[model samples]
Target: MASDSLLLTADFPRTVRGYAPSAVDEFLRSLGSRLDALQNQLDQQAARCEKLTADLSAQAKELAGYRLKEAALAGALVATEQRRAEVEQEAAGLVERAREEAEGLLAHARAEAEQIVGEARVRADQLVAEARQARQAEEARILDLCAEFDAAVETMRRTLEAHLALLPEPGSTLAELSLGGLAVADAPDSLAQAA
Candidate 1:
């Protein structure tokens, strides 16, 4: 049906001589072979176009999948950035607190050290005062003992002089008799000088 227009039609007149039969038959056969080659070329071109269309559709689908993956990765990157920011903020807060605590500890240590030094100074002063008092008291006791010794020596000298006045004169027998070389002549003078 599609090749109807290309077909050769015979219109021989009833009174005129018709075309040569062998030549017409040869021309028809050559035309039919050319038509057949043209139809084969058209069918090949259609098959190639269909394969190209199918390849284009597959490429479009692959492009859509890549776009979806890119969008998902973008969202994940944004979330990671947000998390990093939060962690940094928290670390900063902790560092600030640690610094404040360290400062407080340093201040407390300084105060304690000062207090200890003050107490040591007070104790040292008290010890020096006590030693000075003890030294003064000992010196006073020594002076009192020296005074008592002098008083006892003075009383003994007076008693010896009074007892010598009660003895006999030097020309008497008692003065001639030696009693372990005890001469009473210079007794008062020696006792006064020794006292």
Candidate 2:
């Protein structure tokens, strides 16, 4: 045969006596629902935060790429500016060389012109002197020939009158006589034949 044991319990306080069993049950159920709603809100906020963080990181990476490209372009710009300066310097040297060459050529041309003018002046003066000498010689020859011709004419006049008295009434004229020691055949035979 088995025997059963009885259990004894202490009495509740006055505040605990006014507590309703159904009311306690309702409060616990409400609390559970509120906790579930809060958990749902917190989960949504965390998901939004993750998406925003991912977008911000993507934007930062894109900005870094843009900055790198800008830096490369800046380097290229500097290189171009340096090359331009070098080219300008080379061009300036070329211009100076060209100007020097032009000046040298101008000097050479001026010297050549002066030399040519001087030569022409000297040649012209020589030709003028030679012409003057030739004219003086020809004039002196004419004067000498005139004096000899006057003497010969005087001798012929005295002899011609004596010879003309013995001749017939028809007399020889000056045109028929040889004058200035020249005859009709005075030129050389070859020259006469060619003429």
Candidate 3:
């Protein structure tokens, strides 16, 4: 760990016999030169290591950010999948409810239609019966009128015959008596003809 200045400035103890000062100085200088070269190489390596460590630190930070992003993306995917499932389930439930409501409405409509048809049939039958009864009543009334007319004609004919019988003989006293513009003798024949 000695520096070049430290090696040059070093002191040695005097002895009866010892290594030469110049030789020691020459060896010290050579060792110092080698150490300087090694130190330069070591400094270069340390700087490279520092740069590599900085790059690694930055890469680690970037990697951590990427992991955070991945986790967030994964969580988002899971939430999205769950939302989709909920939506699908809700849609299915809505469809089922709609179908049930439709069926119920259809059944109600069918029942209403049937009731309408049945009521219509009953009303139609009542109308037809009423018409038939009215027609029968009209026919009976017409028949009664015809019978009354015939009975009135018969009564008139009988009254006329009785009056003709009360008249006198044709050429005797009946001729002397005149009834209205006709002679009494002709009254009986006129009455009979009228009857």
Candidate 4:
């Protein structure tokens, strides 16, 4: 029937001067046992090969996943570097703008301060000129007053000298009285006219 069963069944015909029947049967039985042992060993070796192949396939898949992760990490690193460069450029621009603004403010402040100083100088000059003019006017007025006072004093001195010349001497007083009231009255008229 089955090939396996056919191989298990063994029939050896006996010959008179040939192999012994018991010895030939014993040899066949030992060969069957050896063949079975060899078959079992072959089956174990096939199972081990299959297991190793499966492990190799799983390892290949893991390697591919690791490669993908590495690629992703590389891309992320490149992107981070680019972003850092962009930020640095923007910061530099901002710093430049701030510096320019500060410079402009400083220039404007200097201009304003200069203008204020110039105006102050002009005002101070004006005040000094006004004070000089006032002092000159006061000096002129004082000089005029002194001149007027000197003229008044000179006029008074001349008037006093003329009045003194008109008066009689102490010895002439008796002669004037003896000459009568005419001389005394005439002397008063001369003094009044001179004044």
Q: Which candidate is the best by TM-score?
A: 4
Q: Which stretches of candidate 4 lie over 4 Å from their true place?
A: 1-8, 80-195
- In model 3, what lDDT does residue 6 have? 86
What does the lDDT come to for candidate 4? Answer: 0.82
Q: What is candidate 2's lDDT per residue for 1-195, written digit by digit as tens?
A: 011111112233456668775665566556656666676788888999999999999999999999999999999999999999999999999999999999999999999999999999999999999999999999999999999999999999989988776553467653343434444257556744553
Better of 1 and 2 by lDDT: 1
For 140-190, candidate 3 gives per-residue lDDT tens digits of 999999999899999998998988876656775534755666765568776
lDDT of 4 by residue, 64-115 (tens): 9999999999999999999999999999999999999999999999999999
| Per-model lDDT | 0.79, 0.76, 0.87, 0.82
Q: After aligning candidate 1 to the native by TM-score, how far in Å is the CA of 23 from where it should be? A: 3.1
Model 4, clash count?
0
Candidate 2: pairs in clash: none
lDDT by residue (tens digit), candidate 1, 69-158: 899989999999999999999999999999999999999999999999999999999999999999999999999999998999999999
**Candidates sorted on lDDT, descending:** 3, 4, 1, 2
RMSD, every candidate, angstroms: 27.2, 26.4, 28.0, 28.0
Ranking by TM-score: 4, 3, 1, 2
| Number of colliding residue pairs in each model | 0, 0, 0, 0
Clashing pairs in 1: none
